[model samples]
Target: MKNRILSIDVLRGITICLMIVVNTPGSWSYVYAPLKHSEWHGCTPTDLVFPSFLFVVGLSMSISLKKLNRDNHRKIRNKLLKRGAVIFLIGLLLNWFPFYQTNIADLRIFGVLQRIALAFMLAGIVITLIQNTRSLILSLIALLLTHWSLLYFLGGTTPYDLESNISGTIDIWLLGSNHVYSGFGIPFDPEGLLGTLSSAAQVILGYLIGKNTLKHGKPGTKELNHLAVVSLSLIAVSLVWNFVYPINKPLWTGSYTLYTSGIITGFWAILIWVIDIGKKEKWTLPFKVFGQNPLASYVLSIIVVKLFIYVFKINGTTLYGWSFKHLFQRIFENHLASFMYALAFTFIIWLFAFWLYKKGKVIKI
Candidate 1:
């Protein structure tokens, strides 16, 4: 059980590392196609990172819930709500960092951590209030199905189209185009309002998976086989679902959620089998460091990266650009150099994470 849980942490560590790598390319223009998100529909390696983190969050939540008493339902609910709000607010801080530099009304209202906080809180509430894997699973399906129906009916003729999707409309309607992400060359927040339903569903699925894992015996062939069977079943379902709705990370499409989470669940199953059952432990430290302080790592990575990206100039460019221009770009081709810069930046953050892990300073919320 201990080994299996450690494997979860390792998987989480791996996810955070990838998150850093994907988010911190030396130059967006130089990134490999795989490192970039899909233009509209379908999934990419980069797309998997956020969902994978949510999955790990679900698993972690399950483990944490075991420490709490369902008998103290009110207390548990309060703690979960407070934690979610704090994390969500922290994300808001990151979004608003270097504050007063930009208009407050024009600041982005939703972001990575905000989505995570909302999802975690909602999923935690559902799991706590219902207190059963079956109810969690049902709610997960209901959320996904509800999203599909909303997109199909309310999205006009081209419901899933990039520019015209209802999600972007809602962002403009509520937060306004100036306050939403302009990276798409349109006002679209990938982590938008209605998408929260599917995001929460991902966490709920993870919690149920974790709960089911505990109900089964310890980490062994039986658990592995069970996960494998479920993985295969879900892959089949997702593939079929894709034909009807398409798998899109931006919309948090139902098919995308199923396919990515299924594949990640299968991948983590192998990770557990190899690291836990196989008893291989040497290469696990760095990831454990990342997993130990995911929120701190996530928040710090964004804050520091944004600082490097925005402030401090050398040779008439941001420090990050200046570093890449002088260092990695000088040694490697554009694509590889861009990748190397991201990797180096990720490592720099990892060092701090390692320091925190060593000091037992895992920051929650």
Candidate 2:
């Protein structure tokens, strides 16, 4: 408990809150531009949400994997494997929820949680194997470069093309067209397997930051200055890389990974300065509640939304539709109404999270 970082928890909570808002808009058709993910290339506020969550996942791992060493590495690896498997299973189950929406054979095989699971497990194992920070940095660079090489060399003329990108090609080859996501007007899963290379890099970056933070006890002015320099450097390099590689969130490009990781690190550094140092903890209560049980809160939000969309109805309209039509849409513009519904939905989930926090419960995944 002494080593627990409030800033990390608050950051996790912020990410989850935004994840719900962007994900469950009253109508996907009416989302604001910032709320929508970039169609193919470039980054958006929505694009940052998932990667930010993954970055936080990496930070948490810094603490969790600190005990790994030659003596107990085997046991630790097995435990990480189990945890990652369970998380992946949860993501799979989420995709297959209600079981009637899609044919079992054609169900999506990868999603946000699946990506998180893979990134965490893969990054955890890498960190375990390479305990030294210098080696971990080398591994992170290698992961990014390798992902870039594979996509550039094998992805045809338009390497980062949505339809022709090597990442999607790999997904289709491994998971089959029917088993992949078809949202991009093609069977391409953005959270596909190949993207995990860079995703793991994102986690490793977080781990490196966390490891450094823990090593120094708690962050201070010196740590903040160092973090700011490193974060800005990553952003600068990513921007330069974008000229050639392009910053594609769907592709989960190496540039995108670096950009998001840098942005998240800077943001976390600010949080540490404000919350951890300035002692401003009162406003963080709601987010702390959300952060403490992030996985459970996220899963519950998904299920609750599903119930509204898939099960409950009002006068022949799905509950989600009915509520949006009556509660918010009737008063506000379509876009604002859509956003309002998402906000209200998030608040509902927050209530559930707050109750858990009040009960002194943390539902570990």
Candidate 3:
């Protein structure tokens, strides 16, 4: 195995923590604006978390494949398939966890990890099989353009609109309305199958960028300069694309891919410079712990929260609400208490991650 890069681990760890914070709110109604996702048409800080995690998946895949014997192509391909399937399975189980809700028709099929699984699988196959850089770039372009065209032509009457888009239509048709997420007061699955195509493009883009980083082999001034130039160009292009397509995270628009990828590219560079190069890494442990076992951390966090809110209750009130009502909400205003609960939960999970980190256990799937 190749020596892992501290910067990638640190960057991914940052997203892992942010994801926990955003998802485990004391109350959805009490979230700070930045923590909340944009209603429909724009990007927010919370929007960055999912894409950034996907980008790390692509980067991590590239890193792993780079260490393998190139002549052993069959082995590499099989490993990719297994990893994707395992991750998908974990997501599926989490969606239907507790086993009490046995109604198969109502279980959510597309979710964060499910999307990660699909995107990583598609990205891995395309990036691995098409070794030619030019061909891979072309494939990436084809995916984005095709998705855009389909959204415009095939989406029912108001294609980009919330209720009538091609995404909601296709998912409701394929998965049945009962399976699609109804959280938004409509039948729309954010992590739906159709969006996987564009989402895969983001992963592919990360793989290509990561391949370049590997080619450079070490983080340095040269790496920082090139990344900055590339990021700026991408951001400019995304800004122009925004006028036409708009940067929508739920839809995972091509422009959103470009915009977030560009922003994170620069952010990744900074982390590389600060943590790996400058030797100023005294405070990077918590995030690195999260990165080491990101999927495990996320799955466990969700399960714990779900149990507290749904399955395990105290005196007929959910442990989740009961804590907020008596401990947090009773002390502070409702919103601040809600926010504190999220932070406390995040800290609790961090302790779990820290123990895993100390034990030197990194759960890959």
The whole-model C-alpha lDDT of candidate 2 against the native structure comes to 0.91
Model 1: how far residue 303 lies from native, Å: 1.3
Measured with C-alpha atoms, the lDDT of residue 365 in candidate 1 is 55
Q: How close is every model to the real structure, measured as TM-score? A: 0.96, 0.98, 0.96
- Could you give the candidate ranking by lDDT, starting with the highest? 2, 1, 3
At residue 305, candidate 2 shows an lDDT of: 88
Best by lDDT: 2
- Candidates in order have lDDT scores of 0.87, 0.91, 0.86
RMSD of 2: 1.0
Top model number, TM-score: 2
Model 3 C-alpha lDDT per residue in residues 235-313, reported as the tens digit of each score: 8999999988888988888899899999988899888889878977879988989988898899989899889977988
- Kindly list the per-residue Cα lDDT of model 1 for residues 51-165, writing each as its tens digit: 9999888988777777555688779888999999998899888998878566798899899999998998888888888886677788899989998998889899999998678
For model 3, how big is the CA root-mean-square deviation? 1.5
Model 1: residues with Cα > 4 Å off, grouped in runs? 1-4, 67-70, 216-218
Off by over 4 Å in 2: none
